[model samples]
Target: MTRLHTLFLIGMLALLISTPTFALTGRVINQTLNRPEPDIEVSYILHETGDVTVVRDTTDSKGQFILDVPSDPGAEPPPMLFARYNGIDYPGNPAPAGDTVDIPVFETTESDTAISLSSHHILLDAQAGTATYIFIVHNHGDHTYLTGGDHGHGLEIPLPDGVTDFIRAPQGVHLHGTLLVDPRPIIPGNSQTFFTFSIPPSNRIAQRITYPTAGMDLLVQPTDTPVSTTVLRDLGDVTLGTNVFRRFGAEQLAPGTQIDIALSSPETASNLQTPIWIAATSMVVVAILVIYMRTLKTVPNRRTILLEQIADLDERYESGELSEDDYKNRRNALKAEVIDLSDSN
Candidate 1:
């Protein structure tokens, strides 16, 4: 071989060996066992553009893992690592390449001891006759809640009335008769689950929420949707997605509390054509005040409006939601008008 050719080949081999390899380092700590865990599988997931890459490695005797990930030119490496134990995912802190982090895992349990409800939200689309139920459940205990040891009978999800068919549900959960059985473990922190169902055409629905809620909200879409409930306080209207909804909320409700809601539609076609009744549940108090005052000043023959105001006036009048002086002043005005009309004018 020529001297120059041999020298060139040797130089290329030296450069290849000099380049350093890229790797990620992390450790898995078993909180339940109160020590480091060995022989645990750790995964590193990276998504670049439309392509996804996952690298896996097992922990050593010291509970440490080193994943040798192939570095792409001008690409960024992911900083988070994940470890799964007892069907719950444990995520480590974000660390750059060549840095170390620790992931914590726990043992599994079937007991529902520390399980609590953080928030329960129900979204009802009146126009579509659909009801969607959402729940944010938290496990405050140190161990993960697993249904494995219970012989597939651990968690119970009560079905809302008028549930005809389901549109969406979480994975690892199946419907058994009227109730749903969820086998998925409720991991140590907050976990959210939701289900949507189609109901027959109706204006009323009742559901028995079986969890003790810290905060619960009931929302109905298309602000015009007539929704009223005795269990919750109207919190006015809140915009969600591209539409507006009537919002109701309550705090610290006991388990197995039933929530009943009803809707009303105008009987006549003229009432339907009457521009969307801005008198939603959120504005009921404001509407009552305006109606009582408008009737005192307008024509006296409009007894229908006066009767309507009295019919709709319930606990809201004395419920402290409206100012006491406001209603009293309107009452005086009505008396003055009655006296003037009764005179010879």
Candidate 2:
């Protein structure tokens, strides 16, 4: 072959070989504004090895970036690519070359306007001199609400005076005297808090609160389970029931609104079987199973769900429920499943 022709053929072969490496293109935008977000950092994380390959460019003025993810033939499965913005990561769908990926990001803002009480379940243990309060706080707004210090998202709840101990607070919340303060930012979604504390024995228990939003579903346990019997002093807008009193509607609780629940031990109140407590005990199992089922939809889903399950299992094992052998076995099984699923994909 002629020298000129040989060089041209070699150049063409190199171009063909490099084409697949530059297949993925991405764009980042402000979800609420539908505008390009420039100068935001992005990353490509490998699914298998946890190896991260960062791109050279942040989103340009047009909120666009291109990544050259070359497939490793030596790796059992082609490494999946993930696009990360800020701290949240998003998986990339496998697509043909030149396909553009759009990533939407929202700017975090402090706002209490969208805060609402989705559910409030109160359980009073008169025998133990304690009360358990479960509150599901929801943020319906587009921005996040930060808690703690001045100018924070305020959710001030007043406890009955003379409480001895603050037993538990959810991961993000902190106990301050008789009040609960969430130190983490409440993302634009539902976050739950379980507050348990000791209180002085009294015929009546009152809950007072001033929140930024209106409406809440209040559930007070009646003469059922191990908890003591509690009667609503004033029905107000609540609908009475035998085992639990439920109130759900657009009943706006004005600031300093107090809900008084009177406690009385009825003759029929009895301790239920221990098996009935399975609902709470099975949370970890249920969470793992749900994640497994959700991941069955796709390989990427499986990878993410399995990783989450592994983390949850570690936490559960550390809490002393799972033995070392059991934890290692389960973790290994999940890792193998992840590998098999990735290989299949």
Candidate 3:
């Protein structure tokens, strides 16, 4: 080939090599119960340490998704791309038991791996008073840090429908003191954050609170799971009553009156039961002492003679006048005398 032709060929080759290449593209669809869950945010993560380059995506109206990720130029083989749809940690429940996708290992090459996540919902409705109900959100998963800032994991709870004119405590953030939402990032293994707040009384029936929609990318080990904890109340409930600054307690609660009571930890529970137990124990000891004192009157009062006999036995034994066996016999005789004197009562 001529030199000019060769140069033109080289330029064409460089252009082809420099062109941007797409790593992988796909969408995360929630196929649970043959339906799609919108508003479920997706995240792309690095498996180790859950350090992630987050790409937030929302499902279409039909639950379809398409992601365009660029190839990593520095990677030798390029890292794999996984789709974490909604909360399902895997993709395509194709198996009979809903098999999830395996999170791929990091590499220098582009890999098309899809991740799916799932969730279960339960309904809990209860009444609250002026006191805030604190929920300490402990992030047991990876990325163990409180991202909720100063408010902690605050969730803005809207007043129930058709209900208003209620008192609010810590009202600046939202209608409710939202900083106490659960599942706040704790050290995946050893650390956690504490959150507390008071829940105000609301007459509304359709109250809503803004809760956390996503969590940190922490690898949950085989033994890792959510552990429930009992809430320990540091103070008794303050109730409005006729007496000044007085309220009814467990001991004085009236029949059929409703009250809020929190479960105590083992140590606190033991302390609570101690007072009654000690009182009963003292009564038992007193009863035993009284019985022993009553039995004393039935014994004879021969103190004078008993002391004389015991003194004589001790003298003989100490003087080396009594053999081992003889000393024992004399001691027994003296003991019998003392017993007989008591019977004379």
Among all candidates shown, the one with the greatest lDDT = 1
Off by over 4 Å in 3: 1-11, 14-16, 31-33, 36-62, 66-68, 73-345
The runs of at least 3 residues in candidate 1 whose Cα sits more than 4 Å from the true structure, single-residue gaps closed, are 1-22, 70-80, 149-151, 200-202, 241-243, 266-345
Error of 3 at 105 (Å): 24
TM-score for every candidate vs. truth? 0.66, 0.49, 0.21
1-345, model 2: which lDDT tens digit per residue?
999999999999998877245546788867667788787666553333333333444778988877666654343223344444544444545344657777656555556677776545555544434456655566677655554433343554667555545655433445566766654444445554556665455555566755633444334334232222223223333332112333322355565666655546522223322354433323422342333334333223324445566666766788997778777776776677667644442
Higher-TM-score candidate among 1 and 3? 1
**lDDT by residue (tens digit), candidate 1, 233-307:** 889898642346788999988888887877775122223112243223213322322343342332112122232
* Residue-pair clash count for candidate 3: 25
Better of 1 and 2 by lDDT: 1
